[model samples]
Target: MSLANVFSIAGSGMSAQSIRLNATSSNIANAETVSSSIDETYRARYPVFAHAMNDAQEEGSLFEDQPKAVGAGVQVMGVVESQEALQARYDPNHPMANEEGYVYYPNVNVVEQMADMISASRSFQTNVDVLNTAKSMMQKVLTLGQ
Candidate 1:
Protein backbone atom coordinates (compact mmCIF):
# COMPACT_ATOMS: atom_id res chain seq x y z
CA MET A 1 0.00 0.00 0.00
CA SER A 2 1.10 3.54 -0.71
CA LEU A 3 1.90 5.94 2.09
CA ALA A 4 -0.97 8.14 0.95
CA ASN A 5 -3.41 5.35 1.78
CA VAL A 6 -2.49 5.73 5.44
CA PHE A 7 -4.22 9.10 5.60
CA SER A 8 -7.39 7.69 4.07
CA ILE A 9 -7.47 4.79 6.47
CA ALA A 10 -6.85 6.92 9.52
CA GLY A 11 -9.45 9.47 8.45
CA SER A 12 -12.05 6.75 8.03
CA GLY A 13 -11.23 5.37 11.45
CA MET A 14 -11.67 8.79 13.01
CA SER A 15 -15.01 9.18 11.31
CA ALA A 16 -16.22 5.82 12.53
CA GLN A 17 -15.11 6.58 16.06
CA SER A 18 -16.90 9.90 15.95
CA ILE A 19 -20.11 8.11 15.08
CA ARG A 20 -19.56 5.66 17.92
CA LEU A 21 -18.98 8.43 20.37
CA ASN A 22 -22.12 10.18 19.24
CA ALA A 23 -24.20 7.08 19.73
CA THR A 24 -22.73 6.44 23.14
CA SER A 25 -23.38 9.99 24.23
CA SER A 26 -26.94 9.75 23.01
CA ASN A 27 -27.49 6.58 24.97
CA ILE A 28 -26.06 8.13 28.09
CA ALA A 29 -28.22 11.19 27.69
CA ASN A 30 -31.39 9.15 27.49
CA ALA A 31 -30.54 6.59 30.13
CA GLU A 32 -32.98 8.03 32.68
CA THR A 33 -35.66 9.18 30.29
CA VAL A 34 -39.09 7.85 31.14
CA SER A 35 -41.94 7.10 28.81
CA SER A 36 -45.57 6.29 29.50
CA SER A 37 -45.57 3.79 26.66
CA ILE A 38 -43.02 1.13 25.91
CA ASP A 39 -42.86 2.02 22.26
CA GLU A 40 -41.92 5.60 23.04
CA THR A 41 -39.01 4.78 25.32
CA TYR A 42 -35.55 5.50 23.97
CA ARG A 43 -33.33 2.52 23.29
CA ALA A 44 -29.57 2.36 23.44
CA ARG A 45 -28.02 2.89 20.06
CA TYR A 46 -24.88 1.29 18.67
CA PRO A 47 -23.00 1.96 15.50
CA VAL A 48 -22.12 -0.88 13.14
CA PHE A 49 -18.80 -0.84 11.38
CA ALA A 50 -17.38 -2.83 8.48
CA HIS A 51 -13.93 -3.08 7.04
CA ALA A 52 -13.60 -1.53 3.61
CA MET A 53 -11.15 -3.22 1.28
CA ASN A 54 -9.72 -2.44 -2.11
CA ASP A 55 -8.06 -4.63 -4.69
CA ALA A 56 -4.72 -3.15 -5.66
CA GLN A 57 -1.95 -4.56 -7.78
CA GLU A 58 1.61 -4.53 -6.49
CA GLU A 59 3.38 -1.33 -7.49
CA GLY A 60 6.54 -2.87 -8.95
CA SER A 61 5.92 -6.59 -9.26
CA LEU A 62 7.43 -8.18 -12.36
CA PHE A 63 5.17 -11.26 -12.43
CA GLU A 64 1.93 -9.27 -12.89
CA ASP A 65 0.09 -11.54 -10.49
CA GLN A 66 -3.52 -11.13 -9.49
CA PRO A 67 -4.34 -8.06 -7.44
CA LYS A 68 -4.45 -8.43 -3.67
CA ALA A 69 -7.25 -7.21 -1.48
CA VAL A 70 -6.07 -4.73 1.13
CA GLY A 71 -7.84 -3.00 3.96
CA ALA A 72 -8.75 0.47 2.76
CA GLY A 73 -10.53 1.68 5.86
CA VAL A 74 -13.53 1.25 8.12
CA GLN A 75 -17.05 2.16 7.10
CA VAL A 76 -20.06 2.75 9.32
CA MET A 77 -22.82 0.43 8.14
CA GLY A 78 -25.48 2.05 10.33
CA VAL A 79 -26.70 2.66 13.83
CA VAL A 80 -28.97 0.07 15.45
CA GLU A 81 -31.06 0.28 18.59
CA SER A 82 -30.49 -2.35 21.22
CA GLN A 83 -33.30 -4.91 21.39
CA GLU A 84 -32.90 -5.57 25.08
CA ALA A 85 -36.02 -5.16 27.16
CA LEU A 86 -36.64 -1.70 28.56
CA GLN A 87 -36.72 -1.00 32.28
CA ALA A 88 -40.19 -0.97 33.73
CA ARG A 89 -40.52 0.73 37.09
CA TYR A 90 -43.59 0.69 39.25
CA ASP A 91 -43.98 4.22 40.45
CA PRO A 92 -47.66 4.75 41.11
CA ASN A 93 -47.22 8.37 42.16
CA HIS A 94 -44.91 9.39 39.29
CA PRO A 95 -46.52 11.77 36.84
CA MET A 96 -45.29 9.84 33.78
CA ALA A 97 -46.58 6.53 35.06
CA ASN A 98 -49.07 4.74 32.87
CA GLU A 99 -52.52 3.57 33.90
CA GLU A 100 -50.89 0.45 35.28
CA GLY A 101 -48.65 2.66 37.47
CA TYR A 102 -45.59 1.68 35.48
CA VAL A 103 -43.11 3.94 33.74
CA TYR A 104 -40.85 2.63 30.99
CA TYR A 105 -37.21 3.62 31.15
CA PRO A 106 -34.58 3.41 28.45
CA ASN A 107 -32.56 0.22 28.14
CA VAL A 108 -29.33 2.19 28.28
CA ASN A 109 -26.86 1.28 30.97
CA VAL A 110 -24.91 4.30 32.19
CA VAL A 111 -21.79 2.35 33.09
CA GLU A 112 -21.67 0.57 29.78
CA GLN A 113 -22.25 3.77 27.85
CA MET A 114 -19.46 5.48 29.78
CA ALA A 115 -17.10 2.65 28.92
CA ASP A 116 -18.05 2.84 25.27
CA MET A 117 -17.46 6.59 25.34
CA ILE A 118 -14.00 6.13 26.74
CA SER A 119 -13.18 3.46 24.17
CA ALA A 120 -14.39 5.55 21.28
CA SER A 121 -12.47 8.56 22.55
CA ARG A 122 -9.31 6.51 22.78
CA SER A 123 -9.82 5.05 19.32
CA PHE A 124 -10.26 8.53 17.91
CA GLN A 125 -7.10 9.70 19.59
CA THR A 126 -5.24 6.69 18.26
CA ASN A 127 -6.33 7.53 14.74
CA VAL A 128 -5.15 11.08 15.25
CA ASP A 129 -1.78 9.76 16.34
CA VAL A 130 -1.60 7.54 13.27
CA LEU A 131 -2.28 10.51 11.00
CA ASN A 132 0.37 12.58 12.74
CA THR A 133 2.90 9.79 12.44
CA ALA A 134 2.13 9.34 8.77
CA LYS A 135 2.47 13.04 8.21
CA SER A 136 5.85 13.10 9.97
CA MET A 137 7.07 10.19 7.89
CA MET A 138 6.02 11.88 4.68
CA GLN A 139 7.79 15.05 5.75
CA LYS A 140 10.97 13.13 6.50
CA VAL A 141 10.81 11.50 3.08
CA LEU A 142 10.52 14.89 1.43
CA THR A 143 13.50 16.16 3.46
CA LEU A 144 15.60 13.26 2.25
CA GLY A 145 15.74 14.93 -1.19
CA GLN A 146 16.85 18.28 0.25
Candidate 2:
Protein backbone atom coordinates (compact mmCIF):
# COMPACT_ATOMS: atom_id res chain seq x y z
CA MET A 1 0.00 0.00 0.00
CA SER A 2 1.08 3.58 -0.63
CA LEU A 3 2.00 6.01 2.13
CA ALA A 4 -1.27 7.85 1.48
CA ASN A 5 -3.21 4.71 2.39
CA VAL A 6 -1.27 4.51 5.66
CA PHE A 7 -2.72 7.88 6.66
CA SER A 8 -6.25 6.71 6.02
CA ILE A 9 -5.73 3.49 7.96
CA ALA A 10 -4.13 5.23 10.92
CA GLY A 11 -6.81 7.93 10.97
CA SER A 12 -9.54 5.31 11.10
CA GLY A 13 -7.73 3.48 13.90
CA MET A 14 -7.49 6.69 15.89
CA SER A 15 -11.19 7.32 15.44
CA ALA A 16 -12.02 3.83 16.63
CA GLN A 17 -9.78 4.20 19.70
CA SER A 18 -11.37 7.54 20.50
CA ILE A 19 -14.76 5.93 20.55
CA ARG A 20 -13.44 3.17 22.78
CA LEU A 21 -12.03 5.72 25.20
CA ASN A 22 -15.34 7.54 25.30
CA ALA A 23 -17.23 4.38 26.12
CA THR A 24 -14.74 3.44 28.84
CA SER A 25 -15.01 6.87 30.41
CA SER A 26 -18.77 6.79 30.31
CA ASN A 27 -18.81 3.37 31.93
CA ILE A 28 -16.44 4.54 34.65
CA ALA A 29 -18.50 7.64 35.31
CA ASN A 30 -21.68 5.64 35.80
CA ALA A 31 -20.08 2.84 37.79
CA GLU A 32 -21.46 3.95 41.15
CA THR A 33 -24.71 5.55 39.98
CA VAL A 34 -27.78 4.20 41.73
CA SER A 35 -31.18 3.70 40.21
CA SER A 36 -34.48 2.54 41.58
CA SER A 37 -35.13 0.24 38.69
CA ILE A 38 -33.00 -1.97 36.50
CA ASP A 39 -34.31 -0.29 33.39
CA GLU A 40 -33.27 3.12 34.64
CA THR A 41 -29.77 2.07 35.62
CA TYR A 42 -26.91 2.83 33.27
CA ARG A 43 -25.27 -0.15 31.59
CA ALA A 44 -21.62 -0.40 30.64
CA ARG A 45 -21.12 0.35 26.99
CA TYR A 46 -18.50 -1.02 24.61
CA PRO A 47 -17.66 -0.01 21.09
CA VAL A 48 -17.75 -2.72 18.45
CA PHE A 49 -15.08 -2.66 15.81
CA ALA A 50 -14.65 -4.44 12.47
CA HIS A 51 -12.05 -4.47 9.78
CA ALA A 52 -12.99 -2.40 6.73
CA MET A 53 -11.94 -3.29 3.26
CA ASN A 54 -11.81 -1.26 0.08
CA ASP A 55 -15.11 -1.85 -1.67
CA ALA A 56 -13.76 -1.11 -5.11
CA GLN A 57 -11.00 -3.60 -4.63
CA GLU A 58 -13.48 -6.36 -3.94
CA GLU A 59 -15.03 -5.99 -7.38
CA GLY A 60 -13.09 -7.64 -10.16
CA SER A 61 -11.91 -5.19 -12.76
CA LEU A 62 -11.91 -5.91 -16.47
CA PHE A 63 -8.33 -4.57 -16.82
CA GLU A 64 -5.17 -5.30 -14.89
CA ASP A 65 -4.44 -1.63 -14.37
CA GLN A 66 -6.53 -1.53 -11.22
CA PRO A 67 -4.80 -1.53 -7.85
CA LYS A 68 -4.80 -4.75 -5.85
CA ALA A 69 -7.17 -5.33 -3.01
CA VAL A 70 -6.13 -3.51 0.15
CA GLY A 71 -7.54 -2.96 3.61
CA ALA A 72 -9.47 0.27 4.07
CA GLY A 73 -9.22 0.60 7.83
CA VAL A 74 -10.90 -0.16 11.11
CA GLN A 75 -14.64 0.51 11.26
CA VAL A 76 -16.66 1.21 14.37
CA MET A 77 -19.68 -1.05 14.05
CA GLY A 78 -21.55 0.44 16.98
CA VAL A 79 -21.62 0.88 20.73
CA VAL A 80 -23.35 -1.95 22.59
CA GLU A 81 -24.46 -2.13 26.21
CA SER A 82 -23.05 -4.95 28.26
CA GLN A 83 -25.45 -7.77 29.05
CA GLU A 84 -23.92 -8.53 32.41
CA ALA A 85 -26.27 -8.67 35.34
CA LEU A 86 -26.79 -5.45 37.28
CA GLN A 87 -25.81 -5.19 40.93
CA ALA A 88 -28.61 -5.06 43.50
CA ARG A 89 -27.92 -3.69 46.95
CA TYR A 90 -30.15 -3.48 49.96
CA ASP A 91 -30.10 0.11 51.17
CA PRO A 92 -33.29 1.16 52.89
CA ASN A 93 -32.00 4.70 53.55
CA HIS A 94 -31.07 5.40 49.92
CA PRO A 95 -33.31 7.89 48.18
CA MET A 96 -33.38 5.78 45.03
CA ALA A 97 -34.17 2.56 46.85
CA ASN A 98 -37.11 0.57 45.56
CA GLU A 99 -40.09 -0.61 47.56
CA GLU A 100 -38.08 -3.69 48.55
CA GLY A 101 -35.40 -1.41 50.02
CA TYR A 102 -33.05 -2.31 47.22
CA VAL A 103 -31.06 -0.04 44.93
CA TYR A 104 -29.94 -1.05 41.49
CA TYR A 105 -26.40 -0.29 40.36
CA PRO A 106 -24.69 -0.77 37.03
CA ASN A 107 -22.46 -3.83 36.56
CA VAL A 108 -19.59 -1.65 35.45
CA ASN A 109 -16.30 -2.84 36.95
CA VAL A 110 -14.17 0.18 37.66
CA VAL A 111 -10.93 -1.79 37.54
CA GLU A 112 -11.81 -3.28 34.16
CA GLN A 113 -12.83 0.13 32.86
CA MET A 114 -9.55 1.61 34.03
CA ALA A 115 -7.60 -1.07 32.20
CA ASP A 116 -9.66 -0.51 29.07
CA MET A 117 -9.01 3.19 29.27
CA ILE A 118 -5.28 2.63 29.44
CA SER A 119 -5.43 0.26 26.49
CA ALA A 120 -7.44 2.69 24.40
CA SER A 121 -5.07 5.50 25.29
CA ARG A 122 -2.07 3.45 24.24
CA SER A 123 -3.74 2.41 21.00
CA PHE A 124 -4.53 6.02 20.20
CA GLN A 125 -0.95 7.04 20.87
CA THR A 126 0.29 4.20 18.68
CA ASN A 127 -1.88 5.38 15.82
CA VAL A 128 -0.58 8.89 16.22
CA ASP A 129 2.95 7.51 16.09
CA VAL A 130 2.09 5.60 12.94
CA LEU A 131 0.86 8.81 11.32
CA ASN A 132 3.97 10.71 12.31
CA THR A 133 6.25 7.94 11.08
CA ALA A 134 4.44 7.80 7.78
CA LYS A 135 4.72 11.54 7.40
CA SER A 136 8.43 11.41 8.13
CA MET A 137 8.97 8.61 5.64
CA MET A 138 7.13 10.58 2.96
CA GLN A 139 9.29 13.60 3.67
CA LYS A 140 12.43 11.48 3.47
CA VAL A 141 11.34 10.10 0.11
CA LEU A 142 10.94 13.62 -1.23
CA THR A 143 14.43 14.54 -0.10
CA LEU A 144 15.98 11.46 -1.71
CA GLY A 145 16.18 13.24 -5.08
CA GLN A 146 18.58 15.88 -3.71
Instruction: Estimate the TM-score of every prediction.
Output: 0.94, 0.90
Candidate 1: global Cα-lDDT?
0.94
lDDT of 2 at 105: 95
At residue 12, candidate 1 shows an lDDT of 99
Report clashes for each candidate as comma-separated counts: 0, 0
lDDT of 2 by residue, 10-77 (tens): 99999999999999999999999999999999999999999998745344667767656568899999
**Which residue runs of candidate 1 sit more than 4 Å off their true CA positions?**
59-66
Return the lDDT, model 2, position 32.
Answer: 93
Note the Cα lDDT for every prediction shown: 0.94, 0.93
Considering every candidate listed, which one attains the maximal TM-score?
1
